[model samples]
Target: IVYSWLFWYHSQLLTMKTEASVLVEVLDINDNSPVFENHPATVPVPEDHTVGDEVTSVNATDADSGFNGEVRYTLLGSAGRFSVDQETGVITLAAPLDRETQDEYRLVITAQDQGRPSHSATTTLDISVTDINDNAPIFSKQQYEATVSEHAEVRTNIIDIMATDKDDGENAIVTYHIVKQEPSSTPLAFTIDEESAH
Candidate 1:
């Protein structure tokens, strides 16, 4: 009986070979926030730009993969003047722009990932509305009446003429000139300063 039991045990040990062990690693979850790349902090746009025109584009990226890496854009405090593409991040003018009314616009752009708990990042987009020569110079008085003595000098300082332009920069710069004199043949008696419009 002992000899038979020993042989059975030896057979069982030979049958039970070495078992192999396997290991697997689990990936990380979405933890990184969206980030913008090579985007301009400030953009200059003409005030006369038509509606629906493309103002600028922004780009962002997420480190996570699959749905977690998908990013959407949002414009905060746009006030219907501008719109942004959620997928493309392209910003367009939604309303007419007027530098006279509002010279600059401060926009906050946000990029949010499509993860379960969305991660977002923000950037400041400063849009400066450039001036346009849309407004014409207007004189304060419709008509001018001045009295000059006959003995007045040729270079005597005449009444100071004032004109104002609503536009900005060079568009608003006013220059005084005598387009038409009282008498066509009369010599250039009066001269005004171009800079001061006097």
Candidate 2:
């Protein structure tokens, strides 16, 4: 009876029972940007970490959901001495690191989002490594020697030698090269520091 009445009195009924549904839509917002939890992450690799040695990583995170959360890494500024994975964020040492020539390096890493006109974030890294004494010191003067006056003070400046190297890390270790002094030459004729004055 009620079904029949509802069908017959639909146009005339003022107060009656009715069923309705509601629909809502949501929009996306750029509430957050990519960030590096810890800036200046660092690591050390052998002067020669083989051909495929994973050096370090650049960790980045996004606060958005879905595709917006996807982050990609890029080695910006200068891709020298390192390479970063676009997907995994793994940074690998491409060339050998020489501490004698370049003991430290500062790199900038960028993280971009997947969204259109994707947002980006950048960070700086301070990479410091130890010397391995692997690189043979190069005699800047090639070959040169001098003799001081026999009456000169026992302690005197005999020679000032310089050296250079090309490596990615500490493996480019450095030391002094004296090549045996003459009988009259003092034992303290030459000296070298582990750190580059640069």
Report every candidate's CA lDDT: 0.85, 0.66
lDDT string, candidate 1, 97-174, tens digits: 888889888999999999889899998898999998999999999987789999997777768778899998888988
TM-score of 1: 0.81
lDDT of 2: 0.66
Best by TM-score: 1
Error of 1 at 105 (Å): 0.8
Worst 10 residues of 2 by lDDT: 1-10
Candidate 1 local Cα displacement, residue 119, angstroms: 1.2
Clashing pairs in 2: 96-167, 96-168, 97-167, 97-168, 97-169, 98-167, 98-168, 98-169, 133-173
CA lDDT, candidate 2, residue 192: 45
Top model number, lDDT: 1
TM-scores, all candidates, are 0.81, 0.56
lDDT of 2 by residue, 12-119 (tens): 557655654444445455566798877446665545455346777878899876677789888864337778889988877777776657776777888988877678
